[model samples]
Target: EGDGAHGGFPADGVHRTSRLTAPPPVPPRSRLPRPRRGPLAIVVAVLLVLGVGTGVWYINSGQFTKVPPLLSKTEAQARDRLDEAGLDVGKVKHAYSDTVERGKVISTDPGVGDRIRKNDSVSLTVSDGPDTVKLPDVSGYRLDKARELLEDEGLEPGMVTKAFSGEVAKGFVISSKPGSGTTVRAGSAVALVVSKGSPVDVPDVTGDDPEDAKAELAEAGLKVRIADERVNSEYDSGQVARQTPDPGGRAAEGDTVTLTLSKGPRMIEVPDVVGDSVDDAKRKLEDAGFNVDEDRGLLGLFGDTVEKQSVDGGDTAPEGSTIKITIR
Candidate 1:
């Protein structure tokens, strides 16, 4: 009885020890996951918030001012008044007005009571007085002088044309491009044509004998004419001597000139010594042409026959030139 086990136990005489224990069961784990953010997404969100703040600041800072609508105030007075009102004066625009005097303010930008930030500019239109000015007649004045007068009157000169002026002297201003009394811009240009003196055609002196070269030149357009002639004794006499400046030369119209003429070359007549010995004949002719010669053989001893001679019967040569004769 003492060894028997309780229901279904082994009846052997061995008793069982306590069973081995296992680790306590693990506690059930929570399934929660960690939150994550990318670098680009975080940067974009930061930039968006900064951009919104900057835009709000830009809108709040922008501001504009309006000028008073006052009329007929002097420019200085308008500016002073605006400054006194804690506003700044801006660009002054000028315009012609029959109703307002020059340098007076005609109107202002944005009327009075315009809310503006500090340093806001208020623009004003200024009067340039009346648009009309009595034009000075500068037709006869020199171009430069006329320009000065026009500029003084705040007018411009325009257009120049040149015309022959029988009354006006050379190099003087003839007239302006535009007739006087024309209204134009203050800096407009005036054209001027100056006198260049009288115009005349050049003279012609071609083919005229130098002896009459001067007279012919006078008949033409030339007032002054010069003729140079050198006689070639070897050339035919009385023909036009050699001319210098050959034919055509230029001279002012109506200019006078000096003339040269040919005096026939100084000449000596050839001596006649026919029927004489060749040597003696040669001596006479040579003296005229400047020498003497003799033939060979029996004719040489007798002084032979005079055969050929230069200048045959009646030809002329320069006074000092020599003529030769052939003796047989």
Candidate 2:
């Protein structure tokens, strides 16, 4: 009976220990107080949502726009369109165009339907209709003055031709190609016809006495001027050596003719070439300021030696006189 009692006591002790070691019952989860969402709180929440949406929209679409169709629109109209598209007007340029009307938009920088940032600038090319000007009347104007007028009118001066005109003074414009008051493209070259005053035949005065030459030129209704310097020529000293506009060239009636007087032929020593080769003799004579004339007799047709010379060695003759050499 004692054993049974001891065993029962141990069993009871184990039961108690089990009860002590058991975990405590979990308390009911306390519920947070129901948030009292007032009008202000609701509005704040709504604003936060809206801000996020706006940020997304701005990043994706709000910051960008497309260029509008602006071709052929007037500048004022284009500006208005750009403003409506939330864009700024950039550089405005003008260019000549044959197809586009004047003062209208010829093209745009970004082009129509091109994507660009909102408020970005767009360049515009405005049209200035076909560049043209009326041909000006420059007749009777001096050549230099006429050219200036052409440039001022946006035209280029072209080929110039001269003709004798009794009415038009020398060095003056007679007329212009395409005539006056004709509409032509800007920068078009305009040819001009200049006048050479009533023509006068220049008289031949070379080899004549200076006074006689001057009187003869004056009788042709021309003025005469003597040159300040004299030149060596075939003419005798104190005679007119040359006249210009020379004998055949025509000149204006009142034009001046300049006469150069001669100082007579220059004397030079003849070179000795009698025993030299034909080529050597010719070279030596020419180097001495004398022209060489070959006299190859039948016997000397193929000969290379110079057998004789017209002028003897050590003699003096006109510098330009011909030196005849006989080859044998």
Q: Model 1 residue 259 lDDT?
A: 38
Off by over 4 Å in 1: 1-121, 126-135, 147-161, 198-328
The worst-scoring run of ten residues by lDDT in candidate 2 lies at 11-20
Please give the RMSD of candidate 1 to the true structure.
19.7
**Model 2 bad stretches (over 4 Å):** 1-49, 52-128, 136-161, 187-189, 271-311, 320-328
| Sequence-dependent TM-score of model 1 | 0.31
lDDT of 2 by residue, 25-86 (tens): 99999999998879999899999999999999999988999999999999999999999999
TM-score of every prediction relative to native: 0.31, 0.55
Per-residue lDDT of candidate 1, residues 7-66 (tens digit): 756777466789899999999998888767889889999999989988886577544444
Find the 10 residues in a row with the least total lDDT in model 1. Answer: 199-208
- lDDT at position 43, candidate 2: 97
lDDT of 1: 0.62
Name the top lDDT candidate: 2
